[model samples]
Target: MPLAVWFVAVVAVSFALAYLNSSGWFWIGAGAVVLLAGLGSGAFPMDLFLVLSAIFALCSVVLGVSPLRRLLVSRSLLAWYRGQLPAMSQTEQEAIDAGTVWWDGDLFSGRPDWGKLLAVPRPKLTPEEQSFLDGETEQLCAMVNDWETTQVYQDLPPHAWQFIKDKGFLGMIIPKKYGGKEFSATLHSQVIQKLGTRCSAATVHVMVPNSLGPAELLLHYGTEEQKNYYLPRLAKGLEIPCFGLTNPHAGSDAAAIPDFGIVCKGMWEGREVLGMRVTWEKRYITLGPISTLLGLAFRLHDPDHLLGSREDIGITCALVRTDTPGVNIGRRHNPLNAVFQNGPNWGKDVFMPLDWIIGGPKMAGQGWRMLMECLAAGRSISLPSSGTGYAKLAARATGAYARVRSQFKTPIGKFEGIEEA
Candidate 1:
């Protein structure tokens, strides 16, 4: 990383290229002159020689940046690098053929497409970390290609869901002790990118658990005992989780409401209990209809009254069993362009022991902050993956179609007007 070492590496590469071409000898000679002059100047100066070397190195970098940016947008450049494409071995091809539809044909072929132009690279992971991504990619391909249209909503095959759980992907960012991969933010980004290319629904499903779920909240504030209890279940997929933040009537304004859910202190069945009874309607709750565990948020009531004082009526989040006494999950709703069964969850007088509150009693009145923390790292990730994948789809389909679909006695891709646009 030092300047001298960097300069040597750059000059060596340049000389190697020069040796390949007979005319490159002249440029090599010029470089040698610059090096000798720089060395001679070094003896007579304080910092002048080092400063000139730095300027030349920086100028070389700036000169390279533009060509690299253009190469990313060039179809011809990708074609030139066709030899670098990892060949689909017979076993890999058979794996695709035996898998689902998304992995078939050009879908998983890593075909060059124009959509790469729109994608902003998030970050790169180490080669070792990126090696884990192919499994995620193949699994995602099967999920996307295998969506079956049922009498009701479209269903992701059970095998696909199981594949996700088995890959150590269900809890990507959870602690290693909890059965998660515990990868860095960069690794998570790569996994998301690979999954994104195959299916948006699968990407969402994979990310929600890793991003805004109890895994993160537990990591942030749960006691060691609490983590030991829940993190493993979540990581293993024994307990499917859903967040309960947005309420139907309240929508995004739930924090401003009163008398949303009731809380009281008492003994339940001889156990000292701080319990809550929630009565609210929440909709568009991702994974809500199918989740086994629900992470609920509500405004608390006073011990003496249903609607407590503002200070006493604090906002709280709880980890509740979706199968708890008064809870009801509705049919799947399809509001988005692509849908995988999401809908409303209603709780009428649902009660749970106070320990169900995340972080126990110590985290009281911090529901909003906790929710924000849960959502912070996940906001740009999920949507960008979806958008990038869709962009790639558009680009690949469009470019290939243009090449093959002809008009006016030529391929559409060759039309001057189209190219002008």
Candidate 2:
């Protein structure tokens, strides 16, 4: 072959080997061997081959060295491309810190631990949970269908709401000691899946409290007094809870929230106490309009360094009654024609005792981490269960329709395309 053809062949072969094996050292070695063969055959000048060999030898040395190899692999072209984007938000960073990468070893490492994956126990429902799911959940579905067709109210009717509360659907994840059903995660997902298939509105209503409510936050981080006061009310449906995390400007970037609370002395219930004056403008808060209790996230400011030496104590989570003096709620947003109560809520100079912070005063600056941990669990369980419910509904409806509707004097489902679908 001509020298130019041989050069092209060598370059192609070197690249192919490197791409296949993910090793640049292989590319250098292959290129050197091809160049040496060409020089031996007098297909290339000795001086040119000598210069090429020197360059290839240097590249091989760099690729072979541990430190240089690590630098090259870590600062990859993909990494450089991703670096142009914004940094991970506080919520994302906290999620990483919260140990979100539980099963990702299978993705990075060539060998996967099949035994560990197989060892995870499948969740089973208790007898009481099974009864509630078979009986009360089915009854609730009928009621939801009636309400949806009648269009009697935009939100769930008062009777339906009361029935859900009475059945303990809102507190599925709360402990039995706290007056809740305390269903297992698997049972909770099952209930949500059933509810989602019937009424997405009702599913959202039930999921908020079960997944990311004051009950969850309080259970994990609330003080003894806080848990005692709130958990039962939450379990019994005496109080409706809404989480206020998304701000008008912040959206998913919870760390960028501009809502703030400044530490100060305040008057509460005709007595003086140490507290924070909170001002927040939040939107897209689920159940905001009808919620009786608010789980608020804000940037805490301690100018006097009362909480710590730092001026900003990062994000903090607190509970504020919807009926609190400065709170402004009741506005609702219509999302996708769904009757779920989601909307904007704001407060001006809302003041509460320092103990109102979830997990008490000691957890004042630890809200971001708390939210991240709760969200990691919530995101994995709730949304996927709901999505599975939707897929189930679609499959059943499509299968029924395909069987009943005929084409070419035969059922459409008999066709290969429809059967595959």
Winning candidate number (TM-score):
2
Provide TM-scores for the models.
Answer: 0.65, 0.83
The alpha-carbon lDDT assigned to residue 275 of candidate 1 equals 71
Q: Per-residue CA lDDT of candidate 2, range 1-421, in tens?
A: 4698787878788678856775756666677778878888778788988888888777777777878866876569568879888987655676568645645668576667788788988777889889988999998987885256337677787788889999998888888898999888888888889987777788888888888768888988899999888999999999999999999788957688999999989788899999999999989889899899999999899998877787888799999999988899956888776788899899988888998999988898788888877885578788888888878878887899999999999999999988787
Report residue 125 deviation for candidate 2 (angstroms): 3.5
Best candidate according to lDDT: 2
In candidate 1, the residue pairs with backbone N, CA or C atoms under 3 Å apart (3 or more residues apart, or in different chains) clash, namely none
How does residue 272 of candidate 2 score in lDDT? 94
Q: Taking the tens digit of each residue's C-alpha lDDT, what string does model 1 give over 365-397? A: 566667655565576565576567767767777
Model 2 misplaced regions, further than 4 Å: 2-7, 10-18, 21-32, 40-43, 67-95, 105-121, 126-128, 146-150, 398-421
Residue pair clashes in candidate 2: 221-359
Candidate lDDT scores, in order, read 0.69, 0.84
Cα-based lDDT at residue 325, candidate 1: 72
Model 2, C-alpha of 66: deviation from truth (Å): 2.9
